[model samples]
Every structure is written in structure tokens, then in C-alpha cells.
Target: MHRSKGIVIGFWVVTALLCLQMGFTAYAQLSMPEVAEAIAQLGFPHYFRKELAWAKLLGVVLLLAPVPARLKEWAYAGFAYTLVSALIAHLAMGHGPESWIYAVVTGVLWGLSYFFWRRLQAPSVGLRPATA
Candidate 1:
């Protein structure tokens, strides 16, 4: 398979994984009072969880859409931001090994999304003149 195709495939795989993770996180937030209690136990701001959940849902939509490159770029940016914040929150709270594992997974997913976003932004063969 072509390298671009491979990148796209990787993008989708990462996207799916993120969607699963974030979707479940959102579900837990929405349905599981225990999750809220847990978040409260961490002593972090509440907005982080709510906003992260929404951002994840929106990011998934952008990845799935056939929109312009700029929007896709923004989508990846959102993913990166969310994941990084999650990593930070986990670290600051002194969670055990699972925290590091989650950070690594989020980093890998962000890297994959970043790779594809950059690829999409590259100038196409038959496209318009390059911007200066």
C-alpha cells in the first residue's frame, strides 16, 4: 500500500481508539455518578472533564468529515491539547503506572493524528499555486 494510504489508515485507527476512549469517558461522566466522585477526589477543576469530553466528540467528527485541511488541522490540535492536558492532570495527581500508560497511549495517538494532518496540509500535485 502507498505510504499516504498507510498514514490515512493509521489516522483512522488512532481516531477510532480515541473515540472509544473519549466516548466512554463521556458516558461515564454523563451516567456514572461514581466517575464524578472520582474526579472530585482528584481535586482538579471540573471543567476539564466536561470540556475534554466535548472536544473528543468534536474531534471525531472532524476526522470523519471530508472537510478542508484547515479544519482537520484544528481537529488534530484539539486532540493534542486534550491528551496533553489529561497527561498533565494524571501526572500532577500522582496516579500509579496506569497514568503513565495512558499518557503514552495519548501521545502516540496525537503523533499519528499530527502526521496525517501534516500530510493533508502538503501541497497536492494538481492543486492551485502554492501560497507564499
Candidate 2:
């Protein structure tokens, strides 16, 4: 039981950090002129930023709300894809580590959140201690 509690704590903490990163980036996409310029420079249409921001907001809602497991799974997959795409785009554009470092760090956070979430879902899986 104590282990389960610890896992729960770890899950929420990591998930919260992931959500904060996504939320901040989404806000940046929506309001930051530099972000707009960067995307446009990358050949994205002007409307992409707003559309991505709304999608991220919806993803955040699904992640935080007590929605169905299927919805949460979709949110997780969306975030994973978003992070990977951002990293790839930054690299492909010849941007240095400064540009893509946050995505790498957040990717780790996302991995942790997914790990703990799966553990929580099947707490009786192989992680459980054998009783005396």
C-alpha cells in the first residue's frame, strides 16, 4: 500500500510538470511573436499556431479531467507525438541544443509520467512485493 501511495505521488508530480510545460508552450505559441515568427520561418502557415494551441489546451483538459482511460491515452499519445515533432523540427532546421533542450527534458518527464500511470493502472502487476 505504501508503495502504491508513493507511485501515485510520483505519477501526479511528473504529470503536473509535463502539463505545465505543454501549457506554457501552448501559451507561447498563441501569444509570443517570436514563436509566430519561428513557425512561419519554418514554413508553417499562420493558422497553425492557433490550431496547435487549441489542441494542446484540449489535450491538457483531457489529461487533468477524470475522463475515460481511452481519452487519457489519446492525450498521452498526442503529447508524445508533439514533443518528438518539435525536437525533430528544431534539429532539422539546424537549431542548436538551446532550441531543443527543453523538449528533451520534457520528454523525460513525459516518460516518467507514462511509466507511473501504467504502474498505477496495474498496481498488482510485477512490481508488487511478494508477501511473507
- Leading candidate by lDDT: 2
User: lDDT by residue for model 2 over 52-96, one digit each (tens)?
Assistant: 888888988998899998999999999899889889989989999
**In model 2, how large is the Cα lDDT of residue 92?**
88
Task: Provide the lDDT at 81 for model 2.
Answer: 92
lDDT of 2: 0.89
List the candidate 1 regions with Cα displacement exceeding 4 Å: 1-3, 124-132
Candidate 2 total steric clashes: 0
Alpha-carbon shift of residue 11 in model 2 (angstroms): 0.5
lDDT tens digits, residue span 1-132, model 1 = 124777678767876776676667777766677877767766767775676567767777777788887887788777777667667766788877665586577678668767775775566674556788
* Weakest lDDT window of 10 consecutive positions for candidate 1: 120-129
CA shift at 7, candidate 1, in angstroms? 2.6
On TM-score, the candidate that comes out on top is 2
